[model samples]
Target: MEYSKHNIFSKVKDSDEYFLLNPLSMQADILNSVEAQRYKDKRIENQQEYFKKGYLVDPKAEEKLFKSKYLDFIDERDSDEIQLFFTPWYTCNFDCSYCFQDEYTNPDEKVSDAVMDAFFAYIDTQFADRKKYITIFGGEPFLNTPDRRASIQKIIDGANQRNLDIAAVTNGYQLEEFIDILKGARVREIQVTLDGTHEVHDKRRMLKGGKGSFDKITKGIDLLLKEKIPVNLRMVVDKDNIDNLLNLARFAIEKGWTKSPFFKTALGRNYELHHCQTNNKRLFSRIEMYQEIYDLVKTNPEILEFHKPAFSISKFIFENGELPSPLFDSCSGTKTEWAFDYTGKIYSCTATVGNVGDELGTFYPKVDLKQDLIEEWEERDVLSIPECASCNVKLACGGGCAAVAKSRTGKIQSADCRPIKELLELGIGLYSKHEI
Candidate 1:
């Protein structure tokens, strides 16, 4: 018997106690110095318990277990539920400074009735065996014009006919105009971005003509909450807006937005995707972003009332009170999720949705697929990646984002590894102080 390769051990700050996390089993054990030493020495072992906990393992047996778990994770990808992201247009009203979609040409191409017909036809025939739902994507799905609103209604109507639930990622500029349509449809949740306080948010998320959008967006959020429609408030964080995060949190609390059960919030790292946005210099790395949030939470605990920064490890611990289940894959690309742009071009995931060369195939007019490329993406997971297979924290990291990997290494087969040790250390400290 030997120490498991998957075990991650770290000392709790300013204390003799330590945490032993087994990502495979999603278990965490807090141990004192003496206890940790005893376990390491195999002096107080019930061999069976030690083996079961993955504190000690036989080499061959460990390999078998890893293989079994990896296979199970891959097999579970045969999910019955299918999430489809449909882009009605690519022309958003807000011209946020860090908008990654800006890398693609903002074509004025609209979703015509013919396109919608082809889309539904493709779904019926190709995805017939699966349950389906639709997520209306941008350029601003709710653009506030009568013609745009009518187009949205048509998309909603199509989904409603199939008893499909609908969700949308919009700028929330014209949410008021579509309230009636939203109320009628099987609305799931609407995701709207609010970078920071009015000053910060308006500057970052502004109208195309450089007008402030704070008032309009807040009004739209108010309407959604009043109607009890679920709203996920997203904040795109970067160096420019990092300082204002706390102020935004305070604002949300003051407005009682945080207290609403129908509301949820998340922070998106403003980073490069297919190509670097103009604000690349101001972008934060994954670990850097989490560190910023950690510092903010430390200074002002009230921010936790609005939303907790659950960087991967912290999220698992907070949600499950355990380490994290071993992840065979990190993303849903080419698997349970697929993205369909306004032109009927299909891609693996949202990150690659509007990318120039990433289209997996076309779904409209007739069903066409680049099976080789699709299979390549579909087969990607931690177990399948050379670097990920040998990493100690592969379970926690899950090989990082496929999009990031592709962009950085020019290959989807690599891992976009985070600073796992630092992240885990931070997570341990953060969660130790806060219960959730």
Candidate 2:
């Protein structure tokens, strides 16, 4: 296969037929190469810069470097250009304990009309000559609020009328009600989370009446299916919900979703930060969990066909020789898209908004999509950020989840890079055992 060794647009070259090298051997190649040495020197210089910026590193040693074009994908931060986000309203009925925007004023405070008008106007001016997308989000988008629903309808109507792409990230509570409204809305994708089964999910995500919400949610999901909406189920994997994942996967497949064109599975990390609920905390044993899931897939190949394997985890294990979270490689709100709150505030990722200091900026009047602001949002001086610069996998990780890194470690400079490194090492061993 032809590969670009570094940047995606770099010169493509052919290699003679040769045996596959394990990750360790590849790392050895990286360390011995002049290019790799230059990368290391640059990395050290960046670390000094990070330290000067008040970032600190842990006592842990850095992982060995590996050579893989996969890391290049993370570094390709320049591909996407245009972006759009639609916040229907902040009136979700279910109160997920870990919700970052849980503290935002309820429906009463949302500028329902102004936001809709501004969004439509913004879309007209901003999206006229550039590729654009519309991402629908909210507290619980399907609430009984007329204004919220109206705003969402306008965006949907506008997008459809203009032949624009649309996607929604919702709690799935009112999915059924909104299904009909969205049927002709030019929506291409929808993401909804199912943390676990009824028992666990109900406790963590309940209604305003403090009632378990699994049944209604399932009903709403069925409603979505009836409307033929393309959907991907996002599961927030953590210590608490890990054990039940296999069963959850099985349940989804049994729903005749195995062969459904819309079927996809997204594994998420549990950032156990303040105000975030931790009821089902012990979701996985990290490495052990990866092993279990991998073994399960090997044992039941059908599951892989039924549900798209969690691409993030699989990439970390088989490709990157690392595992940060199941969805580590996903470009949340940055790469292909971004998030906007009901109040018209823009963020790189929805999860990082309320937590990541004053780094986030407002998008009310209008924000330029062609500027370098997106990359600047998480800029780290490798010389200044000790942990990230010293780590061999920093480029691939981009310093890991900014939210989790901040919430858990109380800083944004250093994140938990150990799990990803270990997973990559384990993957190398597994591949060697299989003679890959």
Considering every candidate listed, which one attains the maximal lDDT?
1
The worst-scoring run of ten residues by lDDT in candidate 1 lies at 316-325
Error of 1 at 186 (Å): 1.0
- When summed lDDT is taken over every stretch of 10 residues in candidate 2, the lowest stretch is 4-13
Model 1: per-residue lDDT, tens digit, 1-436?
A: 8888888887764467777887876667788898778876768546687677886778788889888887777666675477899998889888888787886788877888888888888888878888778999988898777778788899899988888999999888888888999998888899999998888888888898999988988999999999999999999888999999889989999988998999999888887776667856898988888888888888888888888876667667866755555777887887888999778799987888888889999977667999999988888888778898678888887887888899989888888887777787777777788777
**TM-score list, all predictions:** 0.95, 0.68
Off by over 4 Å in 2: 1-76, 81-83, 104-107, 123-130, 274-336, 354-359, 365-375, 378-386, 406-418, 425-436
lDDT, candidate 2, at 120: 69
lDDT of 2: 0.55
The lDDT, on a scale of 0 to 1, for candidate 1 is 0.83
Candidate 1 residue 311 Cα shift, in angstroms, is 2.5
Off by over 4 Å in 1: 13-16, 36-49
